[model samples]
Target: MCGIAGYIDYTGKAGDTELKKMTDALSYRGPDASGQEVFSLNNATLGLGHRRLSIIDLSPLGKQPMFTPDRSLSIIFNGEIYNYREIREELSAKGHAFISGSDTEVILHAYQQWGDECVKKFTGMFAFAIFDEEKQELFLSRDRAGVKPLYYYQHNGCFLFASELKAFFTYPGFEKAIDPQAFRLYVQYTFVPAPYTIFKHTWKLEPGCSMRVDLKSGNIAQQRYWDVLDYYGQPKQKIGDAEAKEALRQRLIKACEYRMVSDVPVGMFLSGGYDSSLVTALLQSGRSEKIKTFTIGFTDAKYNEAQHAAKVAAHLGTDHHELYCSFDDAKAIIPELPECYDEPFADSSAIPTMLVSRFARKQVTVALSADGGDELFAGYERHAALLGIAAKKDKIPAALRPLAATVLRNTPKTVLNKIFSGNTSADNLAKYLDFLQGKTDLADMIDFANQTAAPDTLAGLFTQAASPGVLFRKNEIRKLPGRLDQLLAFDYLSYLPGDILTKVDRATMHISLEGREPLLDHSLIEWIATLPDEMKYRNGVSKYLLRQIVHDYLPREIMERPKMGFSIPLVNWFRSDLRPLFDEHLSEKSLAAHGLLDHKQVAKLLHEYYSGDNYRFTLLWTLLMFQLWYKKWMQ
Candidate 1:
């Protein structure tokens, strides 16, 4: 619910002036108040800036860059600590005194009480920086699931950290060069995974991790404090279906109730999908007052879910609001993409997410989202696909597998598209077929499932292309027991934070609305991870266990609909409303000016896309996003 920016300057050039500019850029994230302070260290000048969104405490006492009573430690934080009251009680029992009800104050005391291990006690989404005045050290930590963003830069004896990349632009002597490997990663995954950003000498502090900077010696070290893998690797809980459902129901209620601990008005985004509906149902069941719910409807029926959301809202008797938008409304948001997402993010669904957040912000200051459900439970179609591929690939005749792969590789994309009937793109089919050519293992299945672009194809597009390490962490991932469990663990590690969580954070914070993910409570995920695989997904149904609990609150007919994920009509838009933007940003002149991508290859790709190669839409969109981001930040 805030924006934090700070730097450790050995050269002594950065101070309140630089801090103000950096924080000023993040005003939309926290417009209630702003704070900036400079601490003179033994060998460096530490500057911290904050933009307050005032979710937990609306009083002046909640203002940050808050300091300890003795002024030995000061901190700037950018998230909510849902369990602060519980932690406060624990700290108070330890003789720690508190003057304010703000979670920021609780964090300061928690750090004092437990030192580096304090993060282990927190149960919330947070990205914070604490400067130990006496120790002359800066400590930074991000929440376990990375629900909040924290980007940092380190080079030439200087260290800078911020909630958003835009703040880094305000720092003096900061370089803007793109990291070649990260660019390739973005091209391959349509998102650059953490521990890597688009720029060199900078990184997103990986989730469940913390860093300590030694101001005196200018040394920095990072360590992982928590990981979901440990839970996944544990033996399955020897619990029955009824017991598991009851246990999950209790945890779900607690998680939802915890997120309702804000001073400001709160609401939920009810997408009519299993995840959102379940969150809305659980929260509304516990309250006498109707919870405010918001949903975005598309005029295009194929992509619309507002009607279903209205049904869920009515069933729960909550206040409901829906915005039905046209292609024009969605297209208008295209130009703002670069500003909404500081990084080059290619999730087309982000457009609708931002629209919904903007809509919800009109009446509520905080909104609860059900994002981590898909990763925590087996809710994704790809999860089923991974399991299905592993179980069925061996059924194919060993001698004819190569022949089938050859036929698929040589088939015309248009023909393949017709055969698949647009259920999936020919590009993905091609990748699957290629995987079939080899001896399919769990690792190979995962690699194929995640392949966005083949390495050879990416090499042809960029002048300097190298594979990112995240793409092939297959060996480590295969250690998990079940195929579904392994895929879920991999996603929770990479895709959950890299794409889904990032989209929600930026889209919500862009308008100063605090977006909370209730489904991502670490304790809930850890317990769910120990359940048997069939309990999560069974008989061709995903989120089977979660659905059973949801059924207890609502009828089966109302909640048994297909999962139509939040998405946009990107291909049709490119053919009509977005054609001009595609031309303007991906123009040969623009590509030549960027001097990173091969203009000739881009031209060829565009030719193919316009010539009915619709599978290439994702690649084209990724390139367009990168081009737009480059113009906005790098130019």
Candidate 2:
């Protein structure tokens, strides 16, 4: 992976100093090397710069702002193409000569052979900008699932594109206004979705899409090349347990093998969970080399998974490294959050993710992650709960439905939490779902926002529930095998790419390390979508098929342990080491200065939580992240 930045100075010539500043700002993304290329078509108006991470080919020949043989196309790219070698061989037979062993060169040749259709031929994550010298157009594309990020700004017929939003600040004319609508969405969703960033003029290129800007006409066009909705209408197929398990095994092995193509050393973030263990086990089965693995443990035993990671590393006989994180480490990293995310991101797991990536980067340049497992398989507890709730709601008699809804509304949240804490899977699922559904009045939560955002903000909750993929149409007579399958599909479209992938991408890229997710392989995801839901979740267990496949390579003890997610001791930290810093950053005066929040309401949340009247850790964290982000980017 690498960092790419450039600008189309349609109003004037982009000088050397401007290009240097843009490229220099992104040096962390590609510490290996850097390159720049300027074109003076239409009176010296377009320039592109790239920072190289040097993963595929360490040779100088692979360095970019690489050009086609005919010199008609010049490109800057960030990401890896797992199928580059296969595509290169095909192009060579067709008389395309290659001067380097890098995937960037393969993309240059592929664009030459297929034109804009080249994106369809690619099967990896990427975000690239290609300047067509002859056509006088700048073409930009992001990968199918947005594994790579591309941010851009357009003002007065000039467009600047880069790997991170911070790069846009290099230009003197860039403004720092916060986009109010984006802030509203961020508060509702905990993330600002694509096509919208925190800044008003800046935007992220949506995944599986492309854009082209014509210099002559000063016009831009955006279009979608792929989407999950395309596959939504297809009929679900059934497979026996034995057949499904074997198919998943083969697909995962192939996915891992494809991602293993790299000139530099490759290791994994082995958290000792089912997801990472499965990837590590597959890599160990085929390779003769000692696979290097890294994990981070917290001082709090309840939050640490390092011991489990070490056990898996020992079983596989691979080189292993472990880092223990303390409350001080979490405090130290808090100040760096604004710079790392470049926007308001409330996922506190980003701290551990960054720690593991930094530790792994010390040992290897590329790291494999098992990120897509929960979304692809029926893993998260929410999926099972949503299914059960839908089933129960459907069975309620029409006459009593309104009364039941009223009763659910009147049920105190604390009482519901108590009722849902039993050992039974169904009870646990119900409790979690009830909490998420936030069945209680929004008046309480609304008071937590800066000010009560518009009532429309709560509409997002309904939109998520009634989203196109989440709920089937009432009249449609489709027979899905179970609720688990539906939940898996929903998460694959939303949570996986939106939250989990975003967390890993930002963390790893911050350290200039390339992190690849093999479990998110498109072929494997599509195949798994066809399997019966029971093959995924059986007897209240998650990742059932994955555990079975892992059993073939490692002992059952390692595969069957209790599930432990990558989490930090936030509740403890809030009451201790982070308290002072948190208070300073989220002071009521600081928030009121932004003029976006109600200081009184914000104070109530902080006061109630600190006094032990409520445990509003997640909500408070989200508010703290936004406050820090505002201080960095807006104020």
Candidate 3:
């Protein structure tokens, strides 16, 4: 894993010092080594820079800006091709020669042989840039699932790209004002989605897509190269229970085995959950050498999974490490949030992710995580409960629907809170939607300065749900399983990428440790997508099939335990240790100084929450994150 940044100066006047500054901003991502390459072609310069973390081949031969044997194509890559060895053998048999035993070399050779179609054969997470020297064209692509990020800025015939938004800021002519549409979406979704960033001129490349920029004409074209729907639409086949179990076992083992092909020592992040435990078990089962496992614990038992992780590690006979996080630790990291996330991000779990990655980096160079399990296998409690409530709502008489909604609307907040008990359901859909509105309604959220281009986040969500062609399989699948599958699929498409992956990437890269996700392997995801919903969630249980598969290698006691997420005691912290900071940062004066939020509304929320009239901790934290981010990046 590494960081890549570069520019194609169509104006033909940019200097190497500019490229150096861009690469220098990403130093935290690749502390092992750095390199830059420049080529002058057709009165323009193509500058490429790379920061290497040195995972696969820890030698100078593996340094990037790697070129084909003829040096016709040059490339800089930022992710691992887990199946590169297999691809390398096939290419070698087909008469391709390689100079190094590195996945970067495989990509360079594969691109030379297959052109843009080479992306179809790749089976790992990657975001890369390849320059076709003869054609004077730049080809940029992101992985199928967007496990990594790539941001680019195009202005005045100059195209600059980087692994992080911070790199773009290093350019002398780059602008820094926040994009209003992006800020509105950040308030609503808690993170800016693809094709939009906090900066007006910058955009994120969508997953499964590639972009090509022509130097002479300054024309940019982007096209989707892969679709998850193609795999989902295949005819279903039934396998016996034994056969299914064995197939799952083989796929997981292969996934783990492939990720273990690193030069440095590797470890697993064991959260004591079924997903992480399964990964730990499989890695132990296949290897003779001891594997290291890491976990973070909180003093509050409700938030602590270290004991469980320790138990699993002991059972698996691995070298285990645990770190106890206190309020001080959380406080120490809060000020560094803006540096970790280049844009305004509000996921609090980022704290634990960073702490764990910091702990893991001390013991291992590479670490594996089980991040995509929940989204792929229906592992969230919300999915099952939403389905059940929607089913019950469907059965209610049409004449009673309005009456029921009226009653729910008139019901006292206290009574409704008691009845639903914090579960977001159709019965309380209006309130939940209100909560998600985040400070303002859709119409009011748009900036007056750019009324012609009012932000349409809700429209974007519907467009995503109703996307045309093969990608619409998610919309079709939603029709089959009540509205819950739609919610889950939306989470898979949006939250999994926007929040979870962002949290992991920043945390792991900040410590210069490469983190890989075996469960997120695209093949396994495609296979799970084809399975019947019943196999995923049976009898109100989430991830039923996954639990059964895990039981094969772990005790029932460990498999049956309740899920404990990597969470902090935000409620307690707000009420105690973080109270002063929260008040100071979210005060009316602070909100007014920011000028993006309405001070009156902010004061109302603070008063209501502190006076025990409302539970608005989540909203407050979102505001706090935005405030801090603005202070760090904009001001």
Candidate 4:
């Protein structure tokens, strides 16, 4: 894994100075070594810079801007190619020779032999840019799940790209103007969605995509190399439940086995959740030596999961390490979030993820995260709630459904909250009603369910129109019959990559730690996506089949417990340990200076929180995160 930065200056004004700064800014992402290169041709300059973490080959030969023997193609890559050894053996048989035992060299040869087709053959997370000197082109590609991030900024004919958004700020001419639409979107979604960044001209390259930029003509061609829908859109599983379970077990073992390839020490982030527990079980089953496991806990009982993690670790006989953080330790990390994320991100779980990554980094260079399991296998409470609402909504006539939805939307949020105080079903009702306003369907409902701020809330903040979320723009889940499939597909396409993966990537990368997700292996995802929805969730239980598989290695008593997320006590902290930050960030002066939020609405949110309706935490955190980011970047 590494960090890459580069620029293609159409006017030849770009040089090594800016390239050095861009690459240097990302040194935290790759603390092992660094390199920079520049080429001038056709009144244009092409520069590539890399910060190497040195996972595969520890020697100097693994240094990048890696190139083929002829030096016609050079690549700056960030991520592991888990199947590189297999690909290397294939290349060697085809008369291709490699100089070092490195995945970077394998990628260079793969590109040399197969051209753009090389990306389709890769099975691991990656975001890379390759410069083809002979063709005078720059090829960029992100892995299928967007496990890695690639951000780019284009203005005045200068194109710059980096692994993190902050690298763009290193360019002297780069503008700091915020994209207003994207800003409002960030407030609503808690993270800027793909194809849009905080800045107008900057963009996030979507997952499973590749682009070829003609250096001479400056024409860019972009396309998707793979799609999860291609597999999920197929008919449901024809095999029996037992067969599906066995198939899943084998695929997971293979994925974990391949991800274990590295020259550095590796470990697992064992949250004691179904996903992480399963990963740990598979990893420990075959090995004689214990694998390292790390978990982060809180002093407060409600927010801590370390006990469960410890129990799981003891049962598995692994080397478990944990840190129970005080509220002050978490609060101390708050000020650095603006720099740590380099974008507006408000997922509260990032706190624990950050602490856990730091804890693991002390012992291991690479750690596996169980991120995609929830989205793949219907593991969230919201999924079950949405399905239940869909069933009831199906009973309503299509003609009258819109009117009923309008009535629900017209109801005051405060009135609903008052009547259903702390009732999860009522919250689901509100979400379903909000979803019903515009489009009364499974796909539209899925989009509405993920919002942190409603349209009325956004309108009160922004001067211009805040367009509806881009999620329901099209029905990509045509073959997904029930609510579960549609919700899964939406979360996979939107939430998983946009918010969840983004949170994990930023947190882990900030500490120069590599995080792998075995559960997210495309092979396993495709296999699970094709299975029946009941296999994933049944009898009011999420991940039912997953639980059965996990039971083989763990006792039923240990595996059966209420689902607890790696979440922090945000509302309590906001009112206590972080009260000063909350007051300062949302004070009238701060609100007035920011000018993107309505003072009255902000006051109302504050009232709700102080009056014991702590449910406003999500919206409050969303505003605080956006406000913090605005001052740090836009100002």
| Number of the top TM-score candidate | 1
Two-way TM-score contest, 1 vs 2, winner: 1
Instruction: Report residue 390 deviation for candidate 3 (angstroms).
Output: 1.2
| Least accurate 10 contiguous residues by lDDT in model 3 | 443-452
> Residue by residue across 1-635, what tens digits does model 4's lDDT show?
88999998877567989999999999989999999999987857999999988788999999989888788999999999999999999999999988899898898899888989999889899999999998899999999999999998888878899999889898876887778788877877888888788888898999999988898888889999998888777888788888988988999999999999999999999988889999999999979989999999887888788998898999999999999998778887777788888889999888888988998999999999899989988988778777766666667787777788777666776765453342333455656665555345667566757877555555776655656444522466744666677788888888898899998988898999999999888888788888888898887789888989999998888878888888988888778768777788888888887576777778888888877876577888988887787688767
Winner on TM-score (2 vs 3): 3
TM-score of each: 0.96, 0.90, 0.91, 0.95
Best by lDDT: 1
Candidate 3 clashing pairs, residues 3+ apart or interchain = none
lDDT of 1 by residue, 1-635 (tens): 99999888898787889889989989999999999998877778889999999998799999989999899999999999999999999999999999898999999999998999999999999999998988888999999999999999998767989999999898886788888889888877888888899999999999999999999998899999998888988999999999999999999999999999989999999999889999999999968999999999998888999999999999999999999988878888888999988889999999999999999999999999999888887787778776765565577787899887788778887876564433345456655676677744666656555546555566788887465654534667788867887888888887889999999999999999999999999999899999998898888888889999889888998988878989978887787767887888888899886688998888887888888877677888999999989888878
Report clash pairs, candidate 1: none
Q: Per-model C-alpha lDDT, please?
A: 0.87, 0.76, 0.78, 0.85
Q: What are the clashing pairs of model 2?
A: 450-597, 450-598, 451-598
Candidates ranked, most accurate by TM-score first:
1, 4, 3, 2
- Positional deviation of 511 in candidate 1, in angstroms? 0.6
Q: Which portions of model 4 show Cα errors greater than 4 Å?
A: 395-431, 434-439, 466-469
Model 2: residue 262 alpha-carbon error in angstroms = 1.2
Across 17-54, the per-residue lDDT of candidate 3 in tens digits comes to 98999998999889989999988878678899999999
Instruction: Estimate, for each residue in 77-105, the C-alpha lDDT of model 2 and write its tens digit.
Output: 99988988889999999999988889999
RMSD of 2: 5.1
